[model samples]
Target: MSVRARGTLGRFLLTLLVALLALGMPLAPANADPTVGPAQDEPLPVTVNLTKITPTFADSSTPVHVEAELTNTGDETITELWIRLQRDQWISTRAQLQIVDDQQPPYAWAMSAPTSLSAPLDPGDSMSVTLTVSRDELVMYDAGAYPILLNVYGTVDGWENHVGQAAFTMPHADQRPDTPLGVSWVLPLIDQPRRVSGTDVFTDDTLATEISSGGRLENILDAAEEYGEQAKISLVVDPALIDALDAMSDGYQVRTDTGNIDGAGAEAAASFLTRLTDVADTSAIIATPYSDVDAVALVRAGMPEVLSDARTYGADIITDVLDTDPITNIAWPADGIMTDDTWQTLVADGVDTALLSGASYGQEDYLESPLGITESASTVLPNGRAIVADPGLSRLLTAAPQYAGGPVPAAQRITAELAMISLQMPTEARNVVLAPPRDWAPSEQLLDDLFTTTTNADWLTPMSLQQVSEGPPVDRGPLQYPATLSEQELPGNILESFAAPLQQVAELGSAFDPEDTDEALWPTRAALFDAASSAWRGGDGSAVSNGLDTANDALATLRAQIHIVTPSDGTYTLTSSDAPLVFTIENNLPWDVHYRIGIDESRSVGLTAEDVGVQTIPGGTRATVQLPTSVERSGAFTVVAQIRTPDGDPLGNDVQINVSSSAYGTAALWVTGIAFTALLALIARRWWRRHLFWAEERRKRADAQAHQLREDAGDHGQHEYRSDDAIVPPDFAGYDVPPRDEHR
Candidate 1:
C-alpha cells in the first residue's frame, strides 16, 4: 500500500476514536444550575466555626473531638443538614505546607456517620454541634500536618449542595523524627515611650491599664512566669519601658490635656517590677536599645552617636533595675529587616550577632538539597553572624491571632509545620528561631498552647538564642532587604525633625560648669531618644513630634530660667563713655550655670560692647556681670543682651536695653578752651599790673632820685662835679639804675 493511503486511514481511525470518547462523556442537563454551589459574591447558606479542637496533636488511640457552631447566614435553609469531618493526605514539606489549602488531597477518613441537625436552621439561626471521631472508626499512619475540612451538607432553596465549610490543620503524631529540630523562642516585651520629657510625669495613663491584671503586659509577664522554667524562652525588654515603670513605682504623675494628675499605676508598676526582677533572676534577658530606637532611621538621619548612647544607657538601666547583665551584643531590628548601611552601622557599634528573618537573604541562592537540607537558620557575614529566623514560623507566632480561623488553628498548624520540617531531614539536625513582633501581646490560652506544643512535640528540642547563634552558618549570598520593609521604617523627615531638639538639649547640657553635674538634662536626652523609636513607624508621627516638642520646651524652660534681668524702666544710664554696663543674671535653676553674655551692638552706632567671658551664677542665686562698653559719642542707643552658652548658642529671650549716656563728650573740650583763654587773660593782666607796679616803683625811685639828685646837684653844684656820675646818668633812663650808680 502507498504511504499516503496508509496515513489517511490512520488519521480516519484516530478521528473516529476521538468522536467515540466525546460521545461517551457525560453532559450537564439543560436545566442544571451553574450557581448551585458557593459563589464568590453570594453568601453561604450556612457557616461553620470551629470553637475548640481537643488534643491539638492526635495519635492512633487518641479520639479527636471538635466543638463547632453552625450558623444559617443565607435567606433559605431547608432540612436534612448533616456535618462530617474530612481529612486529606499528610503534608510532607514546608513548601507544601504553605499551600495546603490549594492542594486537594484525597479524602483519607471521616466520622462513622454524619451528625444530622435536630431542627431545620432558619435565617440568622445558630446551632452548637459536636463531633467525635473515635479511634475505632478513624486511623492514621503518617506523622505530619493533615488538612482537615469540616463540611456541611444540606438542602437549600430546594437544592442539595455543600452549604458551608471550614478548613484547618490536624497534626497526627504517630512517629518521631530521628533528630529533633532545635527551636528557640525570642519573645519581646516592648512598648512605646510613655514618660514626658524632662519631668516625672507620664504622657498618658494607658500604661496603667497595660500593666494591670489581664492587661497586655500582665499577660506577657504571666506567660513568662508560667513557661519560663518549662521552655527556653528569652525575653527582650526595652530599657525605656523599665525606666518609666520604675518612675511609676515611685509615685509619678500623668499629664493630661488639662493638667497633671497622680498616676494610678504605682502599685501595679511596683508589682510588675518585682515580678520582672524575679523572672530575670532565672531567665535569659536581652536588652533593646533605649526605647527600641529606630537604628536605621537614626543612622540615615546622621545621628549615629545616638545608637551608642541608647545602648549604653539602656544597658545601665537594665543592670540597675533587673540586677542582671543582659545580652547586649545582639541586635534585633524591628520586623527583622534592615538595609546594608544599617547592618554596617550595627556591626560598627559592636553588635556581633543579629536576629534577622530568613527572607532577608536571597532564597534562590539556598535551595533545598537532595538530602532535604533547606535554608539554615544562621548565616555568617564579614564582621558578624545573623541568626535567621524562619519567616514562616515567625509570622505564625506573631500574626496568628489575626487569622480568620483564629489562633487555635494557627497553633495546630505551627506544630504541624515543625513536625514536617523535622521529618524533611530526620537524620540531620537543623535549627530554627521563632521571633514575634516587638510589641506582641498574646492571650494566656494562646501562650499556653504554644508553650505546651513546643514541650510535648517529640520532634522539637527547645534551645536558647545564644545556643542557636553558635550553630554553623549558611551562606545565602548578600542580604536582600525588601523595599516594603524599608517603606515601613520610621521616615527620614521625622528623624530630621529630631535634630533641632536633640542639639538644643545637648548644648544645654554642655552649658553646665565642669564641676557641676548635668543630671538634670538626662530626661530631656532620653525623651529625644524616645522620639526616634521604631514604634512611630506607619504612624503620622504626631506622638513623636509631641515628644520632641516637650523636650524642646524643657530646654527652653531651663534656658528661660537663666536670663539677663531687664533693668528698671528698661533703661541704663552710663556716666562715662568707658563705664562698664552692669547686668544682673538670674539663675533660677538648682545648679550652677555657666554662660557668656552676648551683646548685639549692630544697632548701636558708636558703641562697642565686650563679651563677658564665661561667667558662672551659683544655684538659686543671681550674679552681676560688668560688660566693658565703649561709646564714641554720647547719645541714646539700643543694644540687645542675650544669655548664651560657651558654644555661643542663644539660650533665652534677648533683652533690649535703651542706653542713655550723660558723658560730657564735646562740651568738655569747649569748656576747657574757654577756661584756658580766661586763665591766659588773667595771667596777662597780672603780669601787666606787676610790670606797671614795677614801672611805677622805678619811676618813683627815678623821680625821688632825680629830686634827690636835683637837690644834691643843687647842693653839690656848689661843691664838686663828678665825671663818673655824669656818664652813668644816661643809663638810668626808664630803669631803677639808681642803686648801681650809687654803688659805682
Candidate 2:
C-alpha cells in the first residue's frame, strides 16, 4: 500500500479498537494491545436501551441509557457483530429507553413523540444520538466510575480499537409528578362577595336569594391556599370593586334561601364578606402574586414544588379585575369556552391525571365530551377522557363576562352571558339550572335602555374575555376555549361580528387561554397504570380457573372488551361478541379490559332468504352463519357482527367470521342426493326420446284420416279431405272418401 493508503488503513485500525471496546467484544489474541487485520470487522451503530436496567430509584450507579455511533469509519461494510457494555460490572446490558421523548417529561404519562435517527451516517460521518439516562441508573451502574464506557466491534478492523465515553447525570425532567392539575372557578354576578344561604333573593330568583355560589367560592379558594404552593392564580374583577365584596356579608346573619336579608343591599357587598373572611382567617387581602415558570429548566429557576391538588378562586370577569390580572386562573374566556394551551403546560409539569367538569348545568350531554384531548398527545392524559365540571363550576364562571365594568349593567347582560356559557353544564334530572337567555333576565326598564343605548357592546350577544381590551398576565390560567361557535344558534341582529378564542379546554377542563378562569380556581391531575397481570386467578378455585381461562382467551382474541363492573371498587364487565365492531365508555378509573369469543355462525352474509327472522346469538357468544346448501359443500361464507356501547359505538373492531365448508352442517345430504339423481334421470329420459311419442301417435292417426281423404280427393292441390266413413262407400267403414271429393 502507498503512504496515503497506509494512513487510511492505520485510521481504520484505530476505529476498530474503539468499536470492539464499545461493543464489549473480546479481542482475539488477548495478550496483544492491537489485533491483526484478519479479525478486524466493520461495526454498525446501535441504540442501547436502559429501561430494562431497572434503576433502584436514586442509585447513581444505574445509568439511564447508553448508546454510540460506530460506522465502518473504515472501508468495510458491517455485518452482525457483538455489542455489549465495556465491563458488565459498570453497565447493564439490559438498559433500555423504550419510552419516547414526547411521551412524557418524566411523569407517568406515555411518550407522545417518537425518537429517531436524524439521518444515515457514513464513514468520515457523524450522527447526533440521544438516550434517556436516569441519574440513579448511571450512579448505580457505574458505582465509583464518573464516566461510563461502551464498546463497538467490527471484525475487519480488529487492528484498530476505540471506546465511546459518556458522562453521567440526570436532569429533573418531571416536576409535579403526583397529579395533573387544573383550576376551577366561579364568577360572582351579584357583584358582591357576600356569602348567602339558600333563601336570599335580589328579585324573585336565586341570584339574589342563593348563597351556594358564593360559599363554594370561599371553600375552593381555601383549598387552593392549602394545596397550591407552587400554583399561581388569575383573579378577574374590577380593581375598584374588590373591596365591595365584604359589604355584602357584613350582617353575618344566617342566610335562608326563602327570604332576603334586610341589610344586604347591592351598593357594595364588601363589609359583609370582610367579616366572614376574618372568621375563616381568610387571606384574600394578604394574598401574594400568582407564580410562573419556564418548563425547560425548572430546577435552575429556584421554583417551588408544583401543587398536588385542584384549587380555585372566584373572579368577577368584568373589566376591572381582569384589567389587573388579565390572565387569572381562567386564561381565555372566548365564546364561553377555551382549551388552547392548558394540556401542553400540564404535560410539561409531569401531571398524570386530569378531571373535567361540565360548564352548563341544564344543557349537559349524555356523551362524555372529547375535551380538546385531540390536540394533545396521549402521553399526558392516557386515553384522554376526563371528569366533567360540576354544575357548581358553571354557575360561577357565568357572571364574569356580564359583570365587566358598566355604568348600569342590565339584567339582560347577565342573562346573555349565562346562556352562552350554559351549553356544556351538567343536569339535575328534568330541571336544568342553566344560564338565562339574553332577554330572560332583563327588567322592563333595562330592555328599553338596551334598545336606546348601543354604547356598551351589543346587548344581544356576550363579549369574550380576550376582547375586553385587556391583555393577560404573564402566567395566565388557561380556559378550554373554541375557535368559534356555530352562528346558527345566535341572533343575527345581536352584533356585527363575534370572534371566539383560538383554543378550548378538552372535556377534561384546561386550555391555553389568556383569560380562562375556572371554578375552585385550583385543580391537579394524576396518572396510574396497572396491567391485567393476574388475569388467571392465582388461586386454584372454580371461579378462578374459569375466569382466568375466559380472560386469557379474551386477551388472546379481542372479540370482547373487558369492562369492570363499575362502582364495585374492584370489578370487571366483559362484553363479548363475534362481531367486528364494539364501543362503550367508562369514567371510573383503575380498570383494564380484555375479551374472548368463539364463532357461533359460519358466515358473514347469513342468507336464509326464505325466512326473515332476526339472527340471535346468546349474549357473550361469538358469531356464526350457516353455510347455504345451495352453495357447494366446499364453499365458504363470511359472518359479521358489530359490538358497540349502549349508546352505539364500535369497540374492539377487526373481528369477523370466515366460514369453511364441512359435511357437519348438511343434514339432508342423502335425501338431496336421491332427489338430484331422480331429477337428472327424468331430464335424460325426455332428451333420449326426442319428444316423438305423442307426435308419432298423432301423426299415425292423421295418416289414416289422410288416406281416407285420398279416396275423396278430386284434385291433390285443392281437395278437401273427408272422413274415412264419408269418403268410403256406406258399407265400407275403412274406405277412402274419393267419391265425395269429386263432387266438391
Candidate 3:
C-alpha cells in the first residue's frame, strides 16, 4: 500500500475505537451530587425524620440531643439499621445557609457513635432512634449556624449502602451578640367564611370542629395563650371570623342538605371568644379586611367599594366583638402581592402601610447576599411604608411543617438562619418579619418550638409587627410582582362571578325604604365580601359560587314578598269607557317598600292605561292604587299589571286582568239618537191618522143622517123610515162604523 493510504487507514481505526468507547461509557445524571449518597435511581431502603432536637441554639456547656423516626419505605424489609449524627463547618453567610443542601459540607467536625435498631424494620413500619452529641464530641465550634445531617446505614437485601439522610442546621452562640436580630412573627387568625349569606345559618359544621380541642384553630389559640406573652407575636385577625364566632356563641343555626339544624358549637365558640379576648389584651391585634377580602381582585372586579367597606367594617367588628382597639391601617394583600392600581386604591382607602413579600420588590440579587444580611425589612414606598417579609423565613415557616420532620427541622433551620444573619452583621441591628400564609395551619408542636426557639436564642429578640413596621427603612427598587405570584392571586373570572349577586343586592336595597337600606343590604354585602375572600384563590370557586347562590336566593325571597294581589273574580268591570283601574298591592316585608304600579296594555287594542305614581306600602299592609284608564270602544280585553321599582326594575310577577266595559261609545250614541227620532215621527203619524179616521167617521155619519132625513121627507108616507133615520144618528153612537171602501 502507498504511504498516504496507510496513514488514512490508521486514523480511521483510531476514530472507530474512540467512538466505540464513548458509546459504552455511562452518562452522568443531570445535576447529580455523588457525595450525598447512592445513585438517584436507587430506592432508599430507609427514611429518617428528625422529630425533636433539644437545645436548638447550643453553647459550649450544653450538649445537643436529637430524636428521629426511621421508617422502612422500600418494598423489602431492612435489617441492621444504624443511625448517627454528622456536623459540618459553621455556616458563614445567609446564602450559604439557603443553599446548604447543594453544598458539599464535609460534615467531619463531629460524628456521634452509631446506634443500631434491635429488630428488623418491615415495610411501612417506623422505629424511633435517638443520638446525642456531647459538647466535647462536637469540638470547639464557631458562633454560627452549622449544617448537620442524620445519616442512616442499613443492610437491604444483604447490601450495605447509605439508605437515607435528613439535613438541618444547628445554631451555636459562644457569646451573645451586642445587638440581636429583631424577629417579628405575624401569626394569622383567619379561615374560610362559614356562614351562609343573608341568614343566621352556617354552610357547614366544620367550624365547630375547628374551634374544638386538638383543632387547627384550637392549636393556634393554645399557642397564643401559652407563648403570646413570652414572644413578640402579633395576632392578625379576620373580623369576619370574629363576627361569625360571636353569632355562633349566640346559638346560631347550620344549614344542611336536608334543612337547617341547630349548631353544636355555641359553647365552644363562646369559650374561644373569651380566650381570644384575653389573648388580645397581651398581643397586638391587627385587623384584616372583613373576611380577608382580596383587595386586588376586588378592585379588578369593579368592586372597590367592597374593599373599602370591608376595611371599615372589619375594624368595627374587632372593636365590638373583642372589645379591643385594633390596628387597621396595615393592609395585607392575601397573597402579599399587588399592582400599582391596587396600591393606590388601598392608599385612598386610608391605608398607610402594607405587609408585602420581599419578592414583591424583585430584589433577588440582594436577597441572595453572601453575608446572611440583606436590606431592612421595612421599605419606604412612593406614598406608604411596606413591611416586607423575609422570603426564606416565610417559606420555611409555611412549608416546613408539612415535611417529614414536621416543624422541628423547620424550627431549627429558622433559628440557624436568624443566628447566621446576626453573626454576619453583629452590629447592624437589623429587623426581620416572619409572615406566613394567611391560611397557614400550624401544628401545636410547631408553635411551641418556634416560640421556644426564638425566645431561648441569645442572638434573637422577638418583636411585635407594629414595632417591625416602625423599624428603619431601606430602598428596595421598584415593585416587580412576579408572574408566579400573580398566578396565585384570586382569578379575575372568580371575582367577576360576584358582580351579578352584588347588583342584585343593590337592587334589593333600593326596593326597601331609604331608612331600611343599610339594614336590608348589609347582610348580603357582607356575604359578597366573604365570596371575594383570598382563601378562595387556587380553588375551584365552588364555595364562592354557593355563597353567591345563597345571596341571590335571599334577594329573591325578599323581592317575592311584595306583589300585586289578584282580584277575587280575576276580572274587572268598567262602568264607563274612561274610568280608574283599581289594583291592590300587598307588601309582606317587615319594612316599607316603594313601588310604581305599571300597567301593560300591549295585548289590548284601543285601550290606554295611565301610570300610577310611586306608592309606599307599609310593612305587612295592603295599599290600593287607582290608575286612570281610557278605552276607544266598549269590549272585553286583557291587560297585565305589575309593580316595579322607581328605577324601573320589575318586582314580583305580572298579573293578568279581564276587563269588560258596559258604557256606549260616541258612534253607538249617534246611531241610537237617529233611530229614536225616526220612531217618534212614526208614532205621531199614526195618531193623526186615527184622528182623521174619527173625523171622517163623524162626517160620514152626519152625511148619512142627512141623507136618511131627506129620504124620510121624500117618503113622508113611510113615517117609520123617517123615525128610524132620525134615530140613526143616535144609534150611531152604539153602532159599529161601516167599511168605507166605496168609490165616493
Candidate 4:
C-alpha cells in the first residue's frame, strides 16, 4: 500500500504543480517575497525627479521640455497618477541672492495644471513623464532667471497629493535688444611660491609641473588656447610664478623637508613656457608684483619703500624671465581692496588702473541692476581709474557646470543678467569686467559652454583689457578705501619680521651700487619680494617666516666670509708695547667685497687705530689689513675688528680680538726677579749665623781636650807614687774634673 500510493501521490502532485505554474499561480508565500507590499499603516506616495530637457532658449517663441520620473513610494499602488509643473520667475537679482531668503525663494507664481500619468505606478515602481511647454507658457519672456518646480500627485488609499518634487530653471529670452553688454574677462595666473623656506631664488618645479601637466594652470592654458583671439581675455600673471618656472627651466635646486634636491624640471618648465608664450601673443598680459605683495598690508605697515621696490622688481623680473613685455600700467592687488596709500603708491609707480574688489564701491543705488551703471566696475580717480570687479559675474564665471540646476541653468542666470543690462540701455553699451577667483577650478565643458553662450548671445560683446582701459573715464564720486577687516588684517609684527630682511637687502644693494654690478643687485630685490609675498597667509606664515630666516642666514653667511682671522681662543698676544697688528680679512663672496676694517671705539680701551679705511678684497681670496694700534698701558685689551661699507654701513659680522700687551709681561718679570734676590739674601744670613755658632763650639771643645790631657798627666805622676791609694782617688777625681771645668 505504501509504494503504490506514494507513486500515485507523487505523480498527482507533480501534475498539479505544473498546472499551477502554467496558470501563473505563486508558488512561494506572499510574505517571503521582499518586494511584495508595504506596511498597512503606511500611506501612498509619489516622487518626482526632474530632468533638464531644454538647456537653452533663443526667445519666447522657443519650446521648453522638462522630463520627470514619477515613482509610487508607498505601501499600495497609486492609480490615476499625475505630474504637474510649476513655474516661478526669480525676482531677486544675482546681487540680492546673498541677502534674500534662499530656503523658500520668492517666486512670481505657483501651482500649474496637472498632466495625468499614462499608467498606474505600483509600490517600488516608477515611470517617466515628459512635460513640454512654450517659453510664453511659463511667462519667462522678459529676460530673467526662472526657477521651475515639478510636483507629482496621485490617488492612493483615498486621496494623496504630491509627496515629492524636483526643482530646476528655464531661462527665456536670455538676450537683449540692439545694445550689446560689454564683458571683459580677467584670468589670473598665480601660484604660491615654490620654495617657501629656502634661498632668494625659487628652487622648485611646482609651477612647472602645474603649468605643463593636468593641473590648474594647465586648465587655464587650455582655456586660453580654446578661446584664441576671439575672446577678449586678459591675463594677470604673478611674476613670482614665472620666475619660479624660469628657475626650474635650468636644472635648479629645491629645498624639501629632508634637505635639498637638484631638480630636473627644465623640460617641463620649458614646455609650459612655450605654451605660455603662445597664449601671450594674443591676450593682454599683465604682470603682478614679483611676489604678489599684499598691497593693503604693505600700506598699513607704512612700508612705502618696500612697495616701491616691489613694483620695479616685479616688472623687471617678469621682463627678464619671460623675455616679454607686460602691461605695467595696471596693478591688481590681492583681495581687490586697496587703501588710499596703496592707490597713491600705485600712481607713483605709473600704474594707471587698479583692479579692486567690488566692496570698494557703494552699490546701494544700483542693487537691482548693478551692471546698468557704467561705474559699477570702474571708478574714476584723480590720477587713474579703479576698476572694481563685478562679484556676480565673477561668481558666475567660477560656477561649475555641474551645479545644482545644471550647466545651462547656471549659464542662463548669468546670461539673463547680461541681457537685463543690455535691455536697460538700447543704445548705450557699458563695460563689465569679470574676474575669476584666484584659483578657479572649472570643468572644460562648463567653460566651453559659457564661451559659446557669451559669443552667440548677441546681446553681449567681448572687450579686451586694452580697450577697456583705453576708454574715456567716467566722472565718479569720492573713493571709498575701507580698512581691511580684523580677520583679514595682517599683523604688524609679521610684516616687520619680513621687512627687516628687505632693509638688509636695500643696505647691501646700496653698498654695492658704486661697483656697477647690476647682476648682483638683481637677486637681492627678488629675494626681498619673496619674503614679502602675499601667499604667506594664516597660521604664523611659516613659509614666509622661513624665507625671512633664510635671507638673514644668507646675509649672515656672506658676512661671516669676510670675517677677521684670529687665534683659536679669539685672543692675540703682542710682544711689543705698541705696534702694528695685522688682521687677516677673508672675502668668500663670489664678488669683491669693499669694506672698511675699523676698531670698535667702545671696546678699544688700550688700543688706538690708524689707517683703518675702506679696502677692497678680491673674491675667493684672503687679504691682510695691517691696522696700526697704539697701546696706552700694558694690560689685556680687546681689539674690535668691524667690517663696514665704503659709506659706513655695516656689511658683515663683527669680530673681537683679545690682545695681551707686552708691558704686562715685562712688569711681571721684574717682580719675579726681585722676589728671588730677597729669598737668596735671607738664606745666606741664616747660613752665616749657624756656621759661626758651630765654629765657636768647635774651638771651645779643642781647648777642653788640651786641659783634660794636662790633668791626666799630673794624675799619672801621682798614681806612680801610690797605686794602692786608687780607692781614695774618687773624691780627688771629682775635684780634678771641677778644676778642669773651671780652667775651661
**Best candidate (score: TM-score):** 3
**Residue 336 miss distance in model 3 (angstroms):** 1.1
Q: Candidates' TM-scores?
A: 0.76, 0.20, 0.77, 0.68
Clash numbers, per candidate: 0, 201, 1, 1
For residues 438-496, could you state the per-residue lDDT of candidate 3 as single tens digits?
77777887888888877766678888777877888887777777887677667677678
Model 3 poorest ten-residue lDDT run: 26-35
> Which candidate number maximizes lDDT?
3
Residues 1-744, candidate 4: write the lDDT tens digits. Answer: 685476456545644544454255212121211111232243326545444456554465566677666666777877776665555434434444322213433232433346777787888998878887655445454555566556556666776544545555444554446677777878888887665322423455566566665667777778777784677778898877777776677667766777787776678877777788878788778988878877777777888777777777667777776677888888887766666778888888889898865656544223224344434355677688877677656655665333432444455456655654555555775777878777676555556656776666666788876677666655445656554332464556767876666666567654453554445555555555666677764446666566667667766655566667775777776776457778788877677777777788886776677767668887889888888766665768676778787767677677777888775343455676888899898999999989999988886785565456547758755422234422223234524455756866
Clashing pairs in 1: none
Q: List, residue by residue over 78-106, the lDDT tens digit for candidate 1.
A: 57888777664456677776655334443
True lDDT of residue 590, candidate 2: 19
The CA lDDT at 387 in model 1 is: 86
Off by over 4 Å in 1: 1-52, 68-82, 101-112, 116-129, 135-139, 151-166, 200-205, 250-266, 364-376, 493-506, 513-518, 538-551, 574-580, 604-612, 626-636, 664-744
True-structure RMSD, every candidate: 10.0, 32.6, 11.8, 18.2
Which candidate model has the greater lDDT, 1 or 4? 1
At residue 17, candidate 3 shows an lDDT of 51
Alpha-carbon shift of residue 192 in model 3 (angstroms):
2.9
Q: What is the C-alpha lDDT of each candidate?
A: 0.74, 0.27, 0.76, 0.64
